[model samples]
Target: MSIPLLKYSLSTQNQRVDGYEVSPGEEQPRAYNTDNLPSSVEMDEVIWAAYRQIFSEHQILSSTSDSNLESQLRFNQIRIKDFIRGLVLSESFRKLNYDVNNNYRFVEICVQRILGRDVYNEREKLAWSVVIASKGLESFINMLLDSDEYEENFGDSIVPYQRRRIIAQRSKGEMPFNLKTPRYGADFKEKFGMPQFIWQGPVRQFRPQEQRPKAGDPALFLGMVNDLATV
Candidate 1:
């Protein structure tokens, strides 16, 4: 058996360990605060921007006329997240976005779109997914859009975006974005020998380089001895 002596961080597009490119390994913070939101000359421009940010994947934002977007935002008095929810659960979102996706994929997308972060883990994903499976999509969407975590992170005043992550000790100081990934995807379930309906993605086992030994760790001294022996 080959002893896997080296482990790579496996950085890729927009992610890096010690570089300027914004990649996955880093615990990125919110780039801007809602407090001093920019002053746009056109009311429509402002509202349109919010719509695009919330539903960035679809062409829907651009498909929405400036007049309607402006009028709606003005009419609602800019209750940002509420306005977002309306669009997200609209027929357009349902048919265009939700129809093809399975319950797990759908839950994850909604959480990312609305919560601005990945679900905390599979448990968190399943919790919301169960709501979708039993209570149905409307209820599941509402729960995420109106969650306490949502309020705490975005508040009513702001349009949602990705939440900043702090270092998670349990994850060996990995970013929440990385840690919150599903243990497996549809491919992993079918292609691997796992059964269907069970997501197998677990937090990756940290290799030696990704972890540090504690003060009392016997392995710490043992590792040092190993290095000395190599010398």
Candidate 2:
């Protein structure tokens, strides 16, 4: 039997009770939605934006890009949400994210990428993990995408972004999810034998060697003079 999702308390930290205020020099996030895409160029930009958001910056290469999904989106066969779903369920995504991360860590990454926020707490992580264990990855992803939170923020047309990235009180907003959560988990790195520290030994100090000859070592010139005299 499939286990139902466990309830977890929502933390106030993730809640957007305060109004968004941008500092003078801060760059605001640009929202890319299907509503205003008028030309092929715009469509291409939107597609690229979706890839960047879902896969995180630098994670999506030409080889990793889903050509089928892109074609579907281009032909108007799928909405932005479906495109995102395709990406999350794609083979590349499975290898880069799911295969490398455990259920709990993968849950955390999905919440951040799809929901555009951190999991409320460990309990939330556990709750979603139960869904993954029961219904599997597709169901877990569907639940997140179909949630009221996602609908209110991104809906079917708009690409998901980090919500409420800038706060009025704090000097800096929260770190970008990609930077905060690495593509490879600790276990994956350890299993692959990726070195954590490049240089394990202490740095050695350089010392200059004395090049001048001493007075006691002057006999070397006399040997040459005696040889010359004998010749």
Candidate 3:
């Protein structure tokens, strides 16, 4: 039997009544919708936007894109929401995100990317984790995509974006989700035996080559003599 989703309270940290606000000088997010795109070039732009939003890809190559999903979206066979669904359920997403993160961390990432907001708190993380643990990944993704929040924000044609990025009185808005959240968890790095670097030596000044000692410089010979005397 599938477990019910647990209840969690929404925090007011990044909450706002409107999403359309943009400060005078700050650039607004570019919305990409199949409904507005008119040509193949524009369609390609939309595909790029979807990959950027869903996968945090800056410069996606042709081979990296899901050809089957791209074709379906291009032919108007699937809506943008479904395209996003396909990307989320794709094997690349599984290997990069789901396979690397624990349920709690995965829930946090999905809430940021799919829902376009941070998880309210640890309670919310736990709440969604229950769904992942019981219902599985596909069902969890469906629940997020079908939620009223997602429908209201992005709907079927529009790609998802970081919502309410600019707070009313703050000097700076919230950080981009991709920057705030790492691609993989620290535990994954540990499992792979990734190197951890710590600098323990005293700081040293470096000189340019032109200012450095020559091979037979008196300074070099004096340093060598001092080293020999010390030994």
Candidate 4:
């Protein structure tokens, strides 16, 4: 069952949101995960096609070359879906897709891009929403990009595309992702990214210390309780 999250909170042992610990009330530096890892372009056509579909809303950066993107994929062994995820989450993508959208709506649009289909149901919708709320957008995107359903549909090599839209008698209407509607009206055009209701929930449980002792340390040999007692 999904928790009824009203707001989101970001807390860490380190002030850094990326993964760090610091004294409370002290500001921390942020960690960035957008490093350019080496990748390959042996299958350029397949890779490009995936990029087009997943990053349909994003324009290719003047600095981003086809070769660079190819290498990023091959070297990292990044799944087609994950590549799409990187694009969807990229600063370029966030500006276009996430701007002027709220949580429910943002989740719907991302699902369309990554899954190639509208969400199956509300339970599905809330599940993803809570994720975005709790972990922020990047983690939420990772969940869908790495889901079993996604793997089953697109696998590691195949690029993500729209899924089956017609269920014969069971469902109807065109795919929402294909609709020509604008993200919002003039009043809401200023809204950038999801609403607060989806991004401010408190962490369920906080583990302030993530570091473990060295392999041969007495703490390691003594186990967790003994180690903490000594500290």
Q: Which predicted model would earn the best lDDT? A: 2
- Model 4 lDDT-worst window of ten: 25-34
lDDT of each: 0.57, 0.80, 0.79, 0.57
Error of 3 at 144 (Å): 0.6
Off by over 4 Å in 2: 22-26, 168-174, 187-231
Clash list (residue pairs), candidate 2: none
Q: What is the TM-score of each candidate against the true structure?
A: 0.52, 0.76, 0.76, 0.52
lDDT of 4 at 71: 64
- What pairs collide in candidate 3? none
RMSD of each: 16.0, 10.7, 6.2, 22.2
What would the TM-score be for candidate 3 when compared with the true structure?
0.76
Superior by TM-score: candidate 1 or candidate 3: 3
Clashes of each: 5, 0, 0, 17
Candidate 2 lDDT by residue in tens digits, 2-102: 67778899877633676545553354457788886548999999988888888887577776798888888988899999999999888888788888888
